[model samples]
Target: MHVDLTRDSVAMGDDVDAPHRQSLHLTDDASLGDAVSAVLARPYLAQIGGGKATWLVVVDGTVSAVVAQQWAGPRWLADARVRAPGAIHFRYLAQRDPGEVYVEYSRCQGQP
Candidate 1:
């Protein structure tokens, strides 16, 4: 199932005072291929679309990568450690190769 970006909201926690967060939503039904593409598309998700958004990748309840948008992209590789802020981390689990991610936007200066 594809994650309903329209129905979902990205936040730090369930607290009303939690730091407001932006998210790059991917459908739960989205295939692994698509998820990988989305990440790569927005190498700097926080800077591009997801404002303070966390890349929440999960498969079978096992969390995959929890990377910050600013530090995520197509460069992620298996066993690779692409770092960003202390709060972000990317994990490449699916089978894929480099130069596989692509993203475009008319404006990238605001939150998505």
Candidate 2:
């Protein structure tokens, strides 16, 4: 299987540069769901491929699936608000609340 990661990345200046493109290879998995999940999980892709990737094109032989990102990810990974053009989507993975992933830096460990 082949997947294309298209990045409409963000910048501080808010410039609209052309989208970046990268490709991926899969061994056995052939489901549309699986391809989307792999893109969401940021697996095996180069930094430019997965991070900030706003689109995904999954090519399985003659079948091609195009997906878009509705919003930016919490992290730098290429995941958030992903949707296919004509597909019924249930939440792939329910994300945890901010509190669940928060990190506290002021822990008391005494003298090291």
Per-model clash counts, in order, read 10, 0
TM-score of each: 0.29, 0.32
Query: Least lDDT summed over 10 consecutive residues: which range in candidate 2?
Result: 103-112
lDDT of 2 by residue, 1-112 (tens): 5656554334433235334455645544454455455665763222332322222232322113222233333221222243332221211112223222222101211111
- What tens digits encode model 1's per-residue C-alpha lDDT throughout 1-112? 3322211223334235333233545554554446555545753332323343334333333333334444444322222322111122233222222222212111221112
lDDT, candidate 1, equals: 0.33
Alpha carbon lDDT at 98, candidate 1: 20
List ranges where model 2 is wrong by over 4 Å. 12-17, 43-112
For each candidate, what is the lDDT?
0.33, 0.34
Model 1's TM-score against the true structure: 0.29
Q: Output the number of the TM-score-best candidate.
A: 2
Give stretches of model 1 more than 4 Å off.
Answer: 1-8, 11-34, 39-51, 74-112
Q: What is the lDDT of residue 56 in candidate 1?
A: 39
